[model samples]
Target: MATTEMPNWFVTQFNKRAQHIYQAKGNRLKGTVAGADRIEANEAKWRLVGKGEAKEFQRGQAATPANTGRGIVGAPLKTFQFFDEVHDYDSDRAADPNGAQEKEKIFEQGGMALGRSADREIMNVLNTGAATAGNNFIDLGTTAFDAAAAMTMCQRLQAADVPWEGQVYCPLPSLLWNQLLSAKVVNSSDHVGQDLPFVKSTDTRFWNGVNWFLLSDSFFPVPAANKFDVFLYHKEAVGHAPHTELKTYWTWLNKFTCWEVNMLSKGANVLLQQEGIVRLRAPSNTAITLN
Candidate 1:
């Protein structure tokens, strides 16, 4: 029988190497992994953590205005730490996974991540995930994401066996992106990430109209890829939310990796048949106009 061998130095060596790697990538990590609250000052976290109980006086007599107001003191400022796990979709983007995790070394536990693509694509996605607080590593419960399942979601939408003019194929509905964050299906390493919503969820704004797709936009359209254009529901935008709220949502939504499009509507979906919609005949590369 052969004897198995184990080394005691493994853990120590791994920790040392990891620390070195993090120090090397600290600056780049700041941009992607550290949330605004963490990198910037977090007043909310500070006040909550530092709050102390009020002192009660002897009798039920409240005399001075200062007593009525109660002596209030602010808590000591806190240094927010983002030791979050992020799954990267594409490794080529600026904040790649391996690089980002390496930067995490400066944090308390030395952050780590799981990624879905080659080393190059993995690094970038890591960088993006570290970019925010709400963002985290979300799989479809399982690491595997079925594209066929996504397509089936579209094909299965018919009633009484009706074959329609259009269809939508989406990945796991739970993993479908709401904005910048995504539970990307990795290992396949597919770069194409346009998943039109096949069936409407609780979200009320996006629906398939008889002729075209209905879009209930949160705010101003996002910057689309060269292959696609942003569909602005201007009327819906005005009716849905006030201008100030829309502006805030727009800034955040633009950073999202997901782009949701309503499948062909009964009255308004023939925009695909238009002459220039196929390619960029317009001035902007993001030429997704309805007309």
Candidate 2:
């Protein structure tokens, strides 16, 4: 006798499909961060080094190799699990009206929510670490975000020899975004090019060696006496580890009236190289007392 219920392979296929969709659109930092698969059960590890220095060489002989030293970077993995159920009392195949498409949608949306939360946590780590480092903090006390402020941030990174070849992400809060959108240089063709017209200008999105990304207020970490904190960094600044791909399991309910589907994944974030990130703090139209 052959079984007629949903097979194990069917559930596996659904899980793979869900994972594909989740990976494609779930995380904003998917392609931006230094990512790696977690080989160990609950932890990921990597090595980091400081900038190397140059020394005077005598004639053609190779000079003594400089020791930059290395540090081990590691973080514990985490899981973001979700579950939901659909009931179809009168059917043998449970309530899969859309062939489990709705379940996949739930998984994808849940993955996105978790991804956004992780993005915020990673930003907090970077910003706080930058503050402690002392050199990477750019203060804009009670000042609006203007072209000059933008240039100052860029120039500071440049002075530190941070490469400008790749795109720089500026995750700005709505408050700061509005101020930047109203800035003259951002909308003017005079600064960008003759091809850019004010009405159809793409200057705001891509300008001054930086790509602007607007983030929600809750996601943007505002420190004490500050209105907003902007993260301007290269992709190498943060690291990501995913131990388990998005997977799902199903369980039959009493009398096959309903079924439960669970989505699970294990992952975590790390600040790989703090020097590659710059944290800019600024006050909104309202000023707060600075410490």
Candidate 3:
């Protein structure tokens, strides 16, 4: 029997394909927050400096320097890895020329796995931050999310001195997103003018100084049964430090008579500014039925 070996170019193609899929569908919040491509150590730090205010000067007043407070926020990166094995039998079947290749299927699944893991880590950090959000958390009780509720969230963030001029983002669950669509301010033709036209159900929209995006509830860490938290924040509020981008590799295992493909990444997500984030606690099971 002749043993077949995976070509070098084939491995390269597989790696590239896996990476492309990961980038396309991996983290839904990829660009919504601050990110770093590389870090020198296991931890990444972001510098925080207080703002300085200008004071009116008199013609003869002596010049005085004001001291601004400064601090650092750090997040430690952790490795995430996923792997799949393709046995010789499976590989033979995949090469039958009648169906999709086993490697292609593995690539797709591995890419999504890498992406979801990144999202899971980021959401876990957000959930932890929300628990200690202090005045930044809003418990909606049983009330479903709506345009008014969104406005209230905006008000709270603004009160915390969070900039709202095209800097705010709200990632809504499907249920809450549907509820928002029912609001007159969102669906009413009078309010849906050309400047901010309503787009498709899947597209992000801007309204009342906040950019709204719909995200799957699976990405969020539920605080309780039938309850979930929605995060409204500025891009600067959260930080993602990636020690390594998603990478793919494969090797033929002689002992197991199988080929193993692996995907991996290293990163950390942290809430950089408590004041810049607003957490909305809402019932997860409630939703608006469209006509």
Candidate 4:
């Protein structure tokens, strides 16, 4: 294992700067999905409880409820590393005493790199989970979303007996959101009666019983030109666990200094009851129109 002889304050600032950039990317999805179970790894094995069956009861008869089991699984905690090397003798810092600022900036960028890495992992689990949701996937065909279509989706969830109390999120692409706007189906308070200039937003809006979260185009998986995967799920439908937030190390040699940062997280997104999540194949991309 490698070690560092850096000062306590310097290490503290490094971690602080790293977490600032790292958390922004992490919280993008972490803050949204609701119920996630967590477990620590020992000897490279971990287990999470899977969803159990629920059945109707008889009024006056003996019954046997189905047995439940944990989803015994072993997924290595993912690690991401970012590093930079600075040559002490052949660098600007070699002559300037004020070069410490540049060094800190380099560390900050390293932190942001780790943050973006975490963002990819978050998206990975979400996309994979939604894709393999089996019967939970609802195909909207080539038709763009409208008020009636959105309401019918809610009814499907209701039929599945998914809890209706908490917020259900619908993560959709920006272009699909425009379809909603053009159809006059979505309008938030900020967009009400404001004469302000048209500024693009990736904000969430309330419509029907679901909160529609507009994500960047890159965040979605667009397998076809006219279709994109969108998920409408309760917090309980997905899970996320971070075994390690961010661990960093710095080392100095005779001529060059080395630095590295890493993070470990486990994904339990697809284990929840499929009824709580509904994947939709919606019309998307640049050519989308109401006609």
Candidate 5:
């Protein structure tokens, strides 16, 4: 078979494998936020409408029209791509018997690389949202995260009128998760009954009217040594726009005599509402050892 003539089945399988890995490893925040797909051009625009209050109406009174705020928010999509070159010798070697292991390596690596990049970009967007959260940003000083802190986070959102009945989420690092487990209110059955962290034996659980999920330490950016930020927000508070989903392409380079496999995606993560997001600054190095 010619280098350029890859069968349709091969292409389909390659894409399926890469996409599976990408979905499994990339963008832990995928469905947790709002999304706009098939975006036209580089920017995706979302329509924002402000809340309006009702006033007491007198009998036969003329309707009073108030201007409720509304605007267009745009998220700029950026391209993220990863490519690998397979030399003719490597391709020939892969075609040999007992060489099946090498064939899928490139696709796996490409998927993982692109997935990590997507997650990194999402984390950056969270940081940006946190920076601009204004009054919603909370600093816990150097103290560890506890049930009180979690309650405070939930209360802040509730006070701001952000719905908390299955709509709030707190994504934190394992360090903070450990500290939270140390809190008597989280691990003790007396405080939480069967829903206790230790009783549930799960990394993710619903507590204090928020769905808390644990993210790997690598995804979060370290502002300073042993310091990181935890984001608690409503799902509608953030937005993700995808100009293109993960795509893979293969091309034969005549001059280089190599096959270039390229994987890429285009998307943007943006803050949709400041009122619905709360950023908690906490120490990242704190953990509690279980007895």
Candidate 6:
């Protein structure tokens, strides 16, 4: 039997190709153009009717409808203005000859799905402990990464004060043998399941239509009130505008990855300027942290 070792020329060629893919992913997320506001033109401004005779003589009334000025939407900039610009690559060179050769294939394979893996990374930052639960890590925050914690926390979000019911998920989607496992969950985020854009459809054709590629803006955690019926484009969906502050969020996955985003909730809206602060009411007292 003859052994066939891979050539160095092929490895170098593949590495370059893999790197270019990252740029392509960034371009896709940095949508073609920023969208304009979608609010009604009239509701932005209202004219006051003057009292008694002042109202009757509306032509001369200072606060009448005639004097109403052109009003802009309550800050159109808030709609997912995702302006994240990135051009970083792993500067660390491959040391082992085997790693260098094997990684070329692995990188391509992983990068093909890196978009979704990256999406998983973003959520992992929110629930770091759960991300590593399969590895046998004990707990997350005060609660163990068990069914009880996810269920209790999920219900709390559904309550009146912090009314939110977001779908929880396991660390990885494709790796887990969903066929092998009992197709039911007791009470974990994965038990309830998070809904990807086209996840529910049963068409096994094009990934763009149904397959899960690791696009930057493809996966995200949206609150109930924030969830909409329509599936907007990723750029418009996540608000990743060029040269925006939001694009400069913390990188939880790899410290060097620019794909990470702001982890805190701001004001009553997730958009707008990063308020970076959240108020949580616990059994003992309230806890505030800047995301």
Tell me the spans in candidate 1 whose CA falls farther than 4 Å from its real position: 1-6, 26-44, 48-223, 226-291
lDDT of each: 0.22, 0.65, 0.75, 0.58, 0.73, 0.27
Q: Write the per-residue lDDT of candidate 4 for residues 244-290, one digit (tens) a residue.
A: 66777656553334433333323333334456777677776444455
Give the count of colliding residue pairs in each prediction: 33, 0, 0, 2, 0, 13
TM-score for all models, in order of appearance: 0.17, 0.75, 0.84, 0.71, 0.84, 0.25
Model 5: residue 278 alpha-carbon error in angstroms: 0.8
Error of model 5, residue 33, in angstroms: 0.6
The candidate 1 region of ten consecutive residues with least summed lDDT is: 241-250
Q: Which of the two, 4 or 6, has more lDDT? A: 4
Q: Whole-model lDDT, candidate 4?
A: 0.58
Ranking by TM-score: 3, 5, 2, 4, 6, 1
For candidate 2, write residues 1-291 as lDDT tens digits: 222345676576666767665665455544556675334667887667767888877898977866777777888888877777656443334444446555555656666665565566566666665653366778877666776777787787777787787556666777776677666667555433222112131223557876665556777776674566787777667777766756677776665556666777777778776777777887866422211
TM-score of 4: 0.71
TM-score of 5: 0.84
Q: In what order do the candidates fall by lDDT, top score first?
A: 3, 5, 2, 4, 6, 1
lDDT of 1 by residue, 52-155 (tens): 34656768786443333332222122221223222223213213334433223323233211011111121222222221221121112222223332223223
Write candidate 3's Cα lDDT for 244-288 as tens digits. Answer: 867777776777777777788888888877778888998987768
Give the residue spans of candidate 2 off by over 4 A: 1-17, 59-65, 87-93, 96-105, 187-204, 255-257, 284-291
TM-score of predicted structure 2: 0.75
> In terms of lDDT, which candidate is strongest?
3
Scored against the true structure, residue 118 in model 5 reaches a CA lDDT of 67
